[model samples]
Target: MPNIEQFTPTEAYEALREDETAALVDVRSRAEWTFVGLPDLAELGRDTILAEWRQFPGMTPNPSFLDDMTRQMGGTTPQTVLFICRSGARSQDAAIAVSQLMEEAGTPIRCINVAEGFEGDLDGSGKRGGLNGWKAANLPWKQS
Candidate 1:
């Protein structure tokens, strides 16, 4: 329903590097962020917005997601907002939701999804990290 585009992890990273006003939102749970890992944007002098799309334990949608986004952005103007999740589905939904909201609000922010996601799809060995994701794409990341 909104103008949400899909981008590979590398493309998204490049866009973020090129666009000073772009945002990289990680819509993963706190547990995943702590145990799995997170994108390290420190080299670019930027930080990923760690906003949970869903709450942990029960995996419920976060009611204050937009609020958290707004707070993380410090009430800045809407710009290129990128969302990423475990295997991409959740972040895609999150991007669509945010895109629609921004459109309704007349801001029309560019919402993009890291389609391969952070951890990526499961491999033939039933693993994730080794698959096509942010980490697998060889993007900068750090363990928390």
Candidate 2:
């Protein structure tokens, strides 16, 4: 909450593109990234960092999330890193959690939350990715 910033999916993408040191951290589960698709940052000569905030099948919180994220991101925190999940909730939590880890390691990070997330809000029929989100924004993404 201290150093974390919140942005729309488009804003997050733009910020990452503009800042060479910034990285987009997708906090969704591996299943979501694989089945539901994930953002494609290939044009920026980068990839979306997969640091799941929660585990699949059991949907349990990954206790090693922060540690794993630090390792995944190569220890040095990016100037601006966005955390995104299926919805904004988890990513917001991730931003806070990652911030603490970054501080402990003396690697101050600008943790950001993609407020609309990857799937976006549920539509009238309760479907995802249509109302508003990374996918809804029509940003580059690919199914794995």
Candidate 3:
């Protein structure tokens, strides 16, 4: 069993750059993607940008998150799938869930949680995403 890893947005980006099969999975709410934006992986033309959540603006864990993710990947190959969420919490949970699901299915997928998510740290006043994540790494993202 391969160990699951936690990746910085920068490291995740580098993985995408080097591996054609590598994929970034944004597990955040639809609102997060719309409002805060996402990493621009124009290089991976066929790589998927998908949401495991069916709703918007909330942080509740989707019961079907693993199933949705399995559907998104389309198979049980041990592909490098990086999970990202609002902060790092949800993504970490998502990663663990996916890993466990894959293990049970005998697919043995490689999952990484993107530490700090899209909008990472809070500002001095307890704001979010001002310190870490894809935006903090200075990655390319489109604002909504």
Q: Which candidate is the best by TM-score?
A: 1
Q: Higher-TM-score candidate among 2 and 3? A: 2
Query: Is 1 or 3 the stronger prediction by TM-score?
Result: 1
Tens digits of per-residue lDDT, candidate 3, 2-93, equal: 46698898888887778878778888777767777877777556454566553554555577766666676674443788888777777787
* Candidate order (lDDT): 1, 2, 3
lDDT tens digits by residue: candidate 1, 14-107: 9999997888999999999999999999988989999999999899999999999889899774578999999899999999999888888888
Candidate 2 or 1, higher lDDT? 1
How well is each residue in 1-144 modelled by candidate 2, as lDDT tens digits?
Answer: 475677999999899888978988888888898899999999999888888788997889998887777687787667778899987999999889878877787877788899999999999998998999999999999997
**lDDT of each structure?**
0.91, 0.87, 0.74
Instruction: Assess every candidate by TM-score.
Output: 0.97, 0.93, 0.84
Give candidate 3's error at residue 132 in angstroms. Answer: 1.7
Candidate whose lDDT is highest: 1
Each candidate's clash count: 0, 0, 3
Which residue pairs collide in model 2, if any? none
- What's model 1's TM-score? 0.97
